[model samples]
Target: MELYKAAMVLGGVGDALGYRNSRWERCPSGVAILSELKALGGLEGITVSADEWPVSDNTVMHIVTAETLVSDIWSLTDLYREMVKAYVEIVEQIHKRQPDPATIEGCSQLKPDNYLLGWHTPFNKKGSGFGAATKAMCVGMRYWQPEKLDNLVEVSIECGRMTHNHPTGFLGSLCTALFASYAVQRKPVVEWGREMLKVLNAAETYCRKTIRHMAEYQESWFYFETKWQSYLEERGIAQEGQNTPKFPKIYNAEERDQVYREWSSEGVGGRRGHDAPMIAYDALLSVDNNWTELCNHAMFHGGLGGATGSIAGCLYGLLFGMVDVPKGLYLNLEFREKLEELAAKLHKAANEGEAV
Candidate 1:
């Protein structure tokens, strides 16, 4: 299978698996409503049940991103506008279903406070939510110009700002995109981390320069930089005096559970923008290109396991292609065919330099 198809299908599969396993506990109403949509044949023939899993907002946004890119909107500004339009359409469709309040609350945070009446708007707050980051893989993989890494970072940030407008959110999106770009090139996983740090350092400079002109974002940018630095330090990706830690070794189920507990101990597990990618990164590093183990580790994180799993799955799909992903995961996944078709469209667009 093509890299794009592998990434999209595996990512959605991971999202569905994680959503089915983790989200119901805290958002029972949301889960039930989504399940109902599946049963009613309202979600594109996607179904959710005790034996089947359906995709969530993560996959929804991801598909939107892919769709926008393939829509032939080449310029950054046009691309951004198209993405916003696509996102609103998806959100409105869900809203028509009258999702539970808690679910609406989750969706509402994606829109700006001054959102137009009857229209779901992008969040204006400097949120560090993982939603944007989880859906960014396709954007990264869609455009591959090493010389335009800076541009890629900027575009990725813009895609993220459609919902999550915080620097941490942007960073998470940036990291995922950069990793995907590198993965498609068949770079070593360590190279992915090293390239990430290089791009991140440059991105910080870009943020510092850009934020100066956009004073309103200064505070959030400052917070993001400080927190991101500390996050890197904690992961041993950055240190005052020592070599960066090597990619983590693969963990057994017990070890994976322990890592989850440790992360939760800090009151920062599952859903935080930084935490999800961080967990995914750790899982990626721990494995020796073992897609199953990476997904297992990510899924074990609880609550937002789907987001983490999607991130890990994207990287795995990019690196190893679709064959490596477990066949069982696709058995009852929602929109499997659509996801594959969209992925093929994206890959073709990128290769042909034409609108999808």
Candidate 2:
């Protein structure tokens, strides 16, 4: 019954704040799309709801990760740190011209994998459910046992508990981190996308049963008949005790399936939301593609997965090497400055783990 304009807030703030430093060099087309998103937020339309504007799970999730990195203690409950980052986002642009930021926006100190700070699952709240990045914070904090860590799935499961307490949400996180960890690593080492496919397929294999529940995922015909229709039908079909459907060992055997697999709880590309790996996948594939468009799709399609979508979007956009994202949006995405500082801390933590 309520019309939500939070998406517009995210788009507007991202554009306005980012226009200065880290924002992507404006492309005529990208600027146009930015305006479109801005207009959608009630700037032009006679809005029915004003306070209803929510930056959504996308921005909040990013807030958490950005906050976590800057905290004195790497704890998820550190809300104070998060608030600090929210207030001081311009720091991301501090060293932009000096010594050339090793990564995006003078973000030389942070590591790629450690970017995600925390997560939040919907738990049937009818909103973005916790996805991958947040749970990793929760699980990773405990499993500091680097030696025993078997694979990405184990890490994801332990971390997923921070928010997405549900098995379905856990599955999404498992796939996202496993693949992001893999695809990101493969990029500079080997340009070929095939090398990273193993991790993606591996993740899909682990979430096979849940994947089967989605109308499009259970069979090829559903996907062929209608794209988004099947998306709606498969949502929330499984109850607490009904037993979720089984998943598949491979990609959906349908259109452009190989290029991008299912990414959401549906266990397919249509999974909606973000996957850091998917962004890298597309970036590696399309040079002419607009980073803003890719980020928009990842951010907008992601609420079902919540914070995972936001972190995943950042990971993917970041992987494009900073120059990829629109200058206006990246500069003002609520916590860009703290993100760099946080990235440094995360990088230090990661390196400390490696040294030990």
lDDT (tens digit, per residue) of candidate 1 on 1-356: 47777788878776775566444324423234344445745333444432556566677778778887878665765676676567656776545322222223434544332334222234445356677688788877776557657667877877665566566566778878888888777766654654576676677676566443245455555554455455556567664343345534655554554555455424435565666776777777777577656655665443476777778777777777766554656655666777788878767766677422
Q: Estimate each model's TM-score.
A: 0.76, 0.43
Pairs clashing within candidate 1: 110-123, 111-121, 111-122, 111-123, 112-122, 248-286, 250-286
Query: Model 2 compared with the native: what TM-score?
Result: 0.43
RMSD each, Å: 7.0, 15.3
What C-alpha lDDT values do all the predictions have? Answer: 0.62, 0.33
- In model 2, where do residues sit more than 4 Å from their true spots? 1-35, 38-55, 62-152, 187-289, 300-312, 354-356
lDDT of 2 by residue, 225-338 (tens): 132223223332123332232223331212223223444434433232233334333332332235444444332221221232333443343244444444434333444444
lDDT over C-alpha atoms for residue 54 of model 1: 59
